[model samples]
Target: MEVKSSPYYYSLALLFILNLIGTDSLWASPYFQSGDSIESRREVIEFDESLIEAYQADEAYNYFKNVREESAWEKFKHWLSLQWNRFLEWLLSGISEGNFWNYMALVLKILLILGLGLLIAWLFNKYYVVSQKSPPADQSELNLSEDERLIQQKDLSTLIEEAESEGNYRLASRYLFLNILKHLKDYNFIEYQFQKTNTDYKSEITQQDIRSDFSYASRFYEFVWYGDFKLGVTDFKAAKMRFENLIRNIHNSKTHG
Candidate 1:
């Protein structure tokens, strides 16, 4: 083959063009170049080592480290304190908001407390004072109304007439009982005394029939008088018959004895 057309000559021509272009110049191009070292360009920061420890020891910084977990009771107390604070806030908010209901509720609570105090004071005065005072031994010295206190001292017939006239059957029953006691005293069956109870006089009677009659009279009189029973004319008549029969029986016994 001719030298101009030979493949060896073409290869040599291509190598010669590559040598002129140069490796250094091709690598130095912007596309192939690298940036400056990252370490060399880095900013240098300097700080005191002691400052790290100082910051760690600070109360604000070390708060979580020093804190201990709360016990159940302490946790409950904390929760309760928070609830109380919230309640106080709510209560005050009502007033601050000018709520009429909240003001009325406060007033109602005050009135209720005052009412409770008054009730307790009244009970104490009524029950305590009554319990502390000793009852008088004598019937004449009893804590009674003026009329009741002088009942036994008055004439039986007059008292009975007055009680019946006034429609005070209870007072009439009391007069009847006093008359029975007076008859018992006159017959020497019993000694009447202002200090003595009806039971005391009943115990003195040796005769069974008289004692039974006296018992019935006493219970009837007590029911009408001390029991504070109000009686109509019909009821008074029925009760009066019992006392009259007892008085007649007592007279019959005294006459025979």
Candidate 2:
């Protein structure tokens, strides 16, 4: 036998549904009330509009976005790189276009540059090296040979007269140089030594005019005495005058002092 459902059971089911709905409302009430008050009390912050505009307007403000300035070396490298690239491009274009004459011209230009460089190096070596090399031992008169002791032993005046009598002006010029050196040594102007250079003697001289005169005379002597060239009578006369002037200056300094 199947029993029919009662109205009283339906009323209890409806009451249970209503009670669940009211409980949910009770649990949500505090949250909604607090949220309303929090929203009502909240304040809106006002910023200075000029500060934002000024910062955005300043170009230097974006420090991290700045491009670095290239140094001189870096700029040169970049320029060289660009030139090399352009040259390669031109070379490729010429080759692709079958410009045989242009290619030959370029090769000739490079060879010409290399030849010029070699010529410059050869010229520098020939003249500079020859000037610095010690002259032949037989070139100096009296076999003085840069020996301070031998130079001091000989009478340079008598040697100069003999060299001039033979018309060996080169030998005469050498004697003149030795004469001035001897005078300086005898007067205690310079501490003479075989190992010392003319530059060393120049530094030892204290008088300004004497030092200047010595400098001119020393350079001229090195060219005439130590060089592998013939000194004519006219050249010897000029060199003799320079040496005599230096000697006179030395004498004047001693007399005045």
Candidate 3:
């Protein structure tokens, strides 16, 4: 019987052979010239000699010599020049000895691999691990315009009342202060975006000279909102005063400016 080969098998074998050849070519090629090789070797020898000389020099002797010297701009400039020369020498040595293109190619390959890996991870997370689970259609869409101010105010009042009644004074203070800030922003007394951390907002308003008032309120609010710290009646009163003062100042500034 005549020998026969499957076309699919042959094609696969050819592809595998081609890949092997390409890989070999990529790795085995001499990446530097002979002249460059000699120059690099000579430079390395010089560097080694210089390093040995420096190590043999007495550091204590050099420090003593410099101690008696007058501090002058010329001395500083000379020292800087010496440092610059050393830097340039090392830079040139590295370039002459290094496979620059190969290094760049390696970095690019690593980045490409990392990007692909991240893309795959994201796809897995989105599709397999935490697949989309839609909320009820009616509740999915938030009505931002429908009595939003009134709704926010009511929520704010409820939180305060609940905290006060339950003796959760910390919670009451935090909610009250945040509601004041929210109202100030809403009323254009202050230009601020919601969901920003207090630290970030504090930095923005630093030049406005409201740091003390704003920071006090923010710190108290943070303790109540995120920490297990208990708030006393005194602390609550102080926070309330700061919040009110902050709002008043912001509104006054807006009106004046």
**Alpha-carbon deviation at 71 in model 1, angstroms:** 48
TM-score per candidate, chains pooled? 0.40, 0.55, 0.36
The TM-score obtained by model 3 is 0.36
Please identify model 1 stretches exceeding 4 Å from their true place.
Answer: 1-154, 255-257
- Across residues 1-257, which tens digit of lDDT does each residue of candidate 3 receive? 99899999999999999999998886666764344566466643236788677866967546445346657987899999999998556444544557887567556666877999999998886554442332223332222243235335647767677777887786577567667667555654455554555676666564356666777777666555444456787877677777777767766664421
Q: Is candidate 1 or candidate 2 better by lDDT?
A: 2
Report the number of backbone clashes for model 2.
0
lDDT of 1 by residue, 1-257 (tens): 66468898889999988887888788778666587466756898999889998998788886566667999999999999999998667545567667899888767766877999999999986555544444344452224343334444647778778888988776677777777877777677787667777889899988898899899888776665554456788988887888778777777875423
| Candidate 1 C-alpha error for residue 250, in Å | 1.8
Runs in model 3 deviating more than 4 A are 1-151, 154-158, 187-195, 255-257
Against the unseen true structure, what C-alpha lDDT does each candidate score?
Answer: 0.73, 0.78, 0.63
How far residue 96's Cα lies from its native spot in candidate 3, in Å, is: 52
Write model 2 residue lDDT over 65-177, tens digit each, in one string: 85789999999999999999997775455555568787786787678779999999998866676568665666334554555754676677787888898998877777777
